[model samples]
Target: MKSSAATDNSSHHVKCDKNNINDDGNNSFIELPPNSRPLEHQIAGHFYDQSKTKYGLLQHSNGDVLKPLLNPPRGPCEEQFYIDVFCQTSKSKYNSEDLINLRKFLPHYLGTYKCQKMSYIILENIIQPFKHPCITDIKIGRITYDKEANEEKIHRMSKNSVVAEIGFQLSGWKIYRSKYYEYHDKRCVRSLNKTDILHGIAYFYGAPIHLRLDVIELVINKLNELQDYMKQQHTFVLISSSLMVVYEGDDNDQELNKSTFVDVRLIDFAHVFPQTNSNQSDENFLFGLANYIDYMKQLLDKNYVYVPIDKFEHDNKTDTKIYSCYKQLLT
Candidate 1:
């Protein structure tokens, strides 16, 4: 995830026109009613050949924009597995647990369909409610900071003040060392340690340092909870992904006010191995998680100054326990 899964297809009746390809021989988007192009994005073709296919938001003229994806499932069974998972995990066991951490780990899985050489999953186009929202999207990967694009991001975020400005949108996941090391620019993040494993961490929005600490703490707690849940449920094995931390909201507001929106989610599921048919360890989640916290602590210091509970209490009136979880995750 450079800041998301697979499923069955025979059951669903859908088709893609293979003839609808561009002159480049790469696949083009399926022929459909003409729609508006994305506000600012590349029109990437969708024919994944073990190559990283670019995923973008399908902004439609009808004002219905959605996050689009192209990736293979773990196998034929992959699609159905997540469909069931999404169904079971759709709503909380109790309304009171609406803020349950289970749903917080991944983007809202809208649904999926198949076409020529690709399986597309539709997810909630994660956008802020603000008229002009600034987004900082980071795709977490198994690469260390020294050898991946993360180094550039770190440098840019640290020195650039506009990164924190309102109306800024920060989106994109971390780079993969094994898969992306060669094809992607050298500036991408890579594993610096002798071992090839890289843990995931957030920038804490860079330079400011204090805010970085708060963001990192929240991220750690979220990862801790998610890692624990995955192990218990045995849902799936995350191999290599550009998982990300999304922060959106007005900047001028108090720190906690930013709590209106902050999420930790896997960007894509290209390397996700379903545990249903395999014996993959959930260790990757835990390992990456701990590594992320440690990496940040070494740079920003481990001590955390309390982000008052009242900061988010305003938004979580009905879910006071969630507010408690926020405070506890930090402590």
Candidate 2:
């Protein structure tokens, strides 16, 4: 795990000045350090296809991620949320263990970084430890849009039947196997049904049975821990956010010596809202969390292991192998 020492000092807690950031599309004015580059595994968020230098996340040399402050009130909202969670004051009301435990399930916020008048949120790269990380981003909650959303935004979210029916949507996934990274981008995820989503989960953990079980057990435990923390808190509602699940995919068993093999963290807090109208916990997110946990637990049972091979077959990657329970048992 990354150290919190970088954010311990008060100097890192610089207040976000909206005027200082350039949210406009123009990217020529901004200048980044030579050591920084676009985050290679970023699956979602605003991105420029033509220009890698302009938008999206930047990974700094020290292994910290710099996320540009987008247009408000999302930009400001996410910044404040991180501050409340990491830079808690002596008199702050959010100091409860239920909320503070969130640090374990989130990227370490080392405050903000400013460059050439453009502001960015400095965060620890959660996947920095892994040599080959198999990652997936699942957007949580059936109700994706918050109460503050406009009609168009509400309609757009509501139209996503996957989120409405499943309580969660697979945004994108990248798996490492056969010495290659297999990408299932947002466009690919959009075509999947509930069953395909489950298969995708299995595919993510596709490896030797021993390795697969080890990763699944650790991931489920982490999800349960995160769920317990959320159940105890009635302070906030998470909307349009995702749970990023990562595991080492290298053939070498580096995870054996580590405390954990899998890493699950919550990301994309731009739509997080406070629970002001009622004292009820975030049922919208909790419902999704419970459902997600159930799916993960099913993997542990080994009742079934589904692997979508049509894509690989179409690509003529006949040599590539996906682990299946039947295949493992037969061998």
C-alpha lDDT values of all predictions: 0.39, 0.72
TM-score of 1: 0.50
| Model 2 agreement with the true structure over 1-331: per-residue lDDT tens digits | 2465534745253343444434466655344444677776666665533344456688887888888787789987887777777776554445445557677778878878776555788887988887778788988999988888899989988997877877988777777764567666665566667667776677668733333777888888888888888888888889988999988776476555456567899998898876774567888999998998888777777566566544323233332333111111111
In model 2, the clashing pairs are none
lDDT of 1 at 226: 64
For candidate 1, give the lDDT: 0.39
- Which residues of candidate 2, in runs, are more than 4 Å off? 1-31, 48-53, 90-97, 207-211, 254-258, 307-331
Top candidate on TM-score is 2
The alpha-carbon lDDT assigned to residue 35 of candidate 2 equals: 65
Report the lDDT of model 1 for residue 142. 34
Candidate 1 structure quality by residue, lDDT tens digits, 77-175: 333333444544443222222223345565555565444444445454444333223233433333322222356665754442322221111222221
CA shift of 21, model 2, Å: 12
